[model samples]
Target: MINRIKSGIPGLDEFIQGGFPLPSVLLVLGEPGTGKTTFGMQSIFYAAKRGEKAIYMTGIAEPVFMIKKFMSSYKFFDESFIENGRVQFWDLGTSIQTMGPKKALDAITDIVRETKVTRVIIDPLPLAQLFSSPVDYRRYLYDFLAALRNLNVFTIIVGEKADESAADLEAYMVDAVIILYLKSLDNPLVYKNLMRIRKMRGTNHTRDVLSVEITENGMSVLKLD
Candidate 1:
């Protein structure tokens, strides 16, 4: 039997063999407005509430204060968790820009080791443009995830929606891949948020496009079929 970590997203566990497996790397791909960051943060807070050390790192333009300002609207954003030191938020944009890729990755590794974090999130993982070459990025992604696995931590890497070609690499390289989609409906007031699981290692995950709901309470699945 394998130990699993709860995703913190309601109605998501039943499909992914209870939850995410320990020491696994999960890649989440979605469009700009799809809520990938929300999913990651919700999971981290969930794990933190259960006494696990969690870390959320953003390697993009968004500031931590801004993330908190927007996230404060969600029920999953708990003040006590941050106050008590169960979860830590970090910005790797500057590190990646100034110190370069190797040192940026090293900073992450060092923090995780020092804090003994169990759950990790790197929002908008700089894959293509950040690296000088596609080959280098691919190698870095593989080795980075492998290192996290060896440390026995569950990691979630969020990124923008990738094409079919890029998606193939994402599926092959990560232990699991989740794609979040936002479809426009006829009415301007309403839209549909759907979730699709591209691949999940060692688990028979659903292939159907699952209906999802993103509310003040955070994200949840509406219908399995």
Candidate 2:
């Protein structure tokens, strides 16, 4: 049987047929306001609840306190998870901007080395482009992914669809790719939240895009009939 890391997201698990494979990278691509950050938080929360250590690493607007605050509103997030030390958060925004790619890589290396991070979420990795050129960003991602492999951490690199090139670069670099799309249909009542498994290395993934939604509670997926 193939070992799968349960994501703990309702409908999503069924679509992936379990969860993400262990020790692999998954790219979560979406447009702005498409629940990309929320999806990452939920992934980390699920891992932490399952007695696995999870690390939330962000290169964008998400800060430590803010993430915690928003997550707290969700039933899955609580003080015990924090006090018991199942979850950790790191913001690379300032470090990446000030120290540059090499130093930023060092910072990332230090965290993975120090923490027992079974699941890692790097929110909006495209932000790395702001600190370095496209070529340099690609180089940094390659080296970073290599280091993650050595550490054996399952990682999620979140990206916004602001630039098509950035998304293509990330898809080429990661072990798996998941794209979230919001579509508005012609009918007034027609709308949809869809997720497609673009690629997952060494495993067969579903081709049809699955429907998903984000209500006041959190995200949910609906397996296609």
Candidate 3:
């Protein structure tokens, strides 16, 4: 069998038997300050090392410079990566502000066509959903995924969870769903981070609730407690 495209995300790749299948939409869900954006950025940087063209698309208010600053702290985010045309950034904040998800999708499609991106990340999709209904958001997501699949690109969509309902539309639309949770432990009086591979279509993924942490270098997957 052909080895899957490994994301090189420490333990994550091993959990998926390799990594996400090519041309699949992987949902990375979490609450605020849980490192979802960092994880997605690191994934794009990892892809760039393999000579893949990557696009970091965001729906948040964060400026590209700020994203690059965080990414630059990691060894994988090298200047040559951008200089050599391996990585790019696209901010959808303004587009989502002016147009809706449908139009925003058109803008995204135009970027993909112009860049031949092999890996793409969409940070904090809730903003895009604000521009449209849940049903319309899901439809646009499906259409976007179909377009990405046609282009043979692996896509990562980030979502912030206000509640379980935050994942309803995405869980039904994407090829894979990864949920990150933060729990308080009374004994230690500390908050513990956890991640679950809620689902991954067409692959035997690890169902264990694993721990995660962010460092000056970047996010790392820790062992399940």
lDDT of 2 by residue, 72-117 (tens): 8877676777787788878777777788767887788778878878
lDDT for 67 in candidate 2 is 72
Minimal lDDT window, size 10, model 3: 125-134
Q: Which of the two, 2 or 3, has more TM-score?
A: 3
Please state the error at residue 166 of candidate 2 in Å.
Answer: 5.5
lDDT of 2: 0.77
Model 3 alpha-carbon miss at residue 48, Å: 1.0
- State the TM-score for model 2: 0.88
Name the runs in model 2 displaced over 4 angstroms.
127-133, 162-167
Where does the lowest 10-residue lDDT sum fall in candidate 2? 160-169
lDDT of 1 by residue, 69-183 (tens): 9999999899899999898988888779888886787778888888899999998777567778878878877777778888889999887764335566656888988988877
Q: Give lDDT tens digits, candidate 3, residues 1-225.
A: 533676757777888878888878888888887878888878877888887888888776587888787678876568888888888877788787788667888888789878988888888664444744666666777788788877877888887774456567677778888888788865568898778888888889887878887776677786676
Residue 39 accuracy (lDDT) in model 2: 84
* Cα displacement (Å) at residue 68, model 1: 0.6
Give the TM-score of each candidate: 0.92, 0.88, 0.89
Better of 1 and 2 by lDDT: 1
